[model samples]
Target: MLVFWNARLVFLSVPKTGTTAIEGAFAPHADMVISHPPELKHAPLYRYNRFFRPMFERACKVEDMETLAVMREPISWLASWYRYRQRNFMQGHPNSTHNVSFDEFVNAYMRGDKPAFANVGSQAKFLEPRPNGTRINHLFRYEDQSRLLNFLQDRIKQKVSLERRNASPRTQLDLSPETLKKYQRKFSAEFDLYNSIS
Candidate 1:
């Protein structure tokens, strides 16, 4: 997460949403950058509200810090995770996807008892609105890089440049139509959230 205190902005890092590239580009200019401990680095909304928000509200006396987040299209996001877990370094691990087909991986994801490989958390849940009205003020589609970058540049008053970092190994992701339909039916919330981000 990148917090620009002067800009009254906090950029929440959603997993598999190209946050590494953004962090690389903006870390130098950010007032506070949390990049250690994966749990802390990729903090979701509830976590932010519970841990970080109080500090800002009480100590900084900043009650209106706007939050920013990027969300990828649902299936595309899953494909990224599937491919990411297939990386060579993940081989032999319980969460590795090296042996599973994209369809199998997704099937596991839909299971109530998901295997480690398909246990990636939901994007929708990560960005849910809080009861106190602290919600994402600037939500961008990861597929649209221009708008996200433009917003960052204008807000930070610095030219932006990005280089891909922590990209997963390349793999063709193909899901059977039946599996796709089942997934969509089971996880409509994911689609609903992504579609609502216009």
Candidate 2:
């Protein structure tokens, strides 16, 4: 979701990155524009699908926009995503009927074969120049939510309270060393970008 004032606070909502919480905090204070779903879309800053450029440009043209996003360690993010999907299966989402295991999901993700999960772009999309040459004003890390909240509070001159609701269950399964290595390679770019920003 994108939040804007006369001054733009464009939040690039990345999936599983506390976006709903961010939206709740900012919605009362800013004009909220829903961009993409948490599972399928990353922040629409850079590396966004080419088709989204026109819409984004139109939105930014009307306001003084400052871009922001939240990110997490990719492995943990993906694992959380997998578990969330698994829970959805348990809850009887029609789409989750197949009910693939986490191990299977990780294999597909590592091979870049999970089409639904694979296409979400890297953090570089937010941190670097866009394909359309637009640049974000700031990028935040999910790992450092307090910092982002503080920054937003300072910018908007209003105290924002973040609340975590509908949190996914924490995994009890420990990642094997080999699996960790595989994920590190699979998400190397995002890992680097997340580290740099944090």
Candidate 3:
């Protein structure tokens, strides 16, 4: 999607899902790169984070770059994200916010209330045509990563291979009948979109 748009690819890093590894791999290939702002510098970073801000606006105007992101299934993604944060961010706090289990997290995600799950960009928005009727040229599935990379190579005329750097921590979950219905309802559009494209 980024290469296709000829705009600087923004990972829009959601928790876990190997964002760091992906950024590391793509940095050399990118003309410009941005990563998570350091803890102390986060406030300052946000002041300058807008793509339309002066520092980036001129560059954006001159360079035809593409912004791209990846997404995963919400239930699986949220479960892994929760575990990743519990290990990395919630270390030794007096009160911990990481007690939720996979099933609990999935319930919240299905309701679109979890921050990690909410952070992934909207596929419907990404796929919708612009006012000028231009649609994003590509949107790839993490499940179909090899094909996505192959398609990118074909577009750029360059050979690139990506290694799988991370996998979901919760490998198994028992979904109740009610929970299954919630997931289907919550992600109906995405499921439809995937089927149409596939």
**For this target, which candidate reaches the highest TM-score against the unseen true structure?**
1
**Clashes per model (N, Cα, C within 3 A):** 0, 0, 7
Stretches of model 3 off by over 4 angstroms after superposition:
1-18, 38-68, 91-98, 112-135, 166-172
By lDDT: ranked, best first: 1, 2, 3
Question: lDDT by residue for model 2 over 64-129, one digit each (tens)?
Answer: 455777777777677667666656435655324135655556666666455564333455544566
Error of 3 at 6 (Å): 7.8
Model 3 root-mean-square deviation: 5.7
Q: How are the candidates ranked when ordered by TM-score, highest leading?
A: 1, 2, 3
Best by lDDT: 1
In terms of TM-score, how similar is model 3 to the real structure? 0.62
All-Cα superposition RMSD per candidate: 0.7, 3.8, 5.7
lDDT by residue for model 3 over 2-118, one digit each (tens)?
Answer: 122343433333344355555556556655455535321111212234332334447545333333344455555545555554554455553222565556655766654555532
Worst 10 residues of 1 by lDDT: 129-138
Which lDDT values do the candidates have, in the order given? 0.94, 0.65, 0.48
TM-score for candidate 2, residues paired by index:
0.77
Candidate 1 residues lying further than 4 Å off, grouped into runs, are none
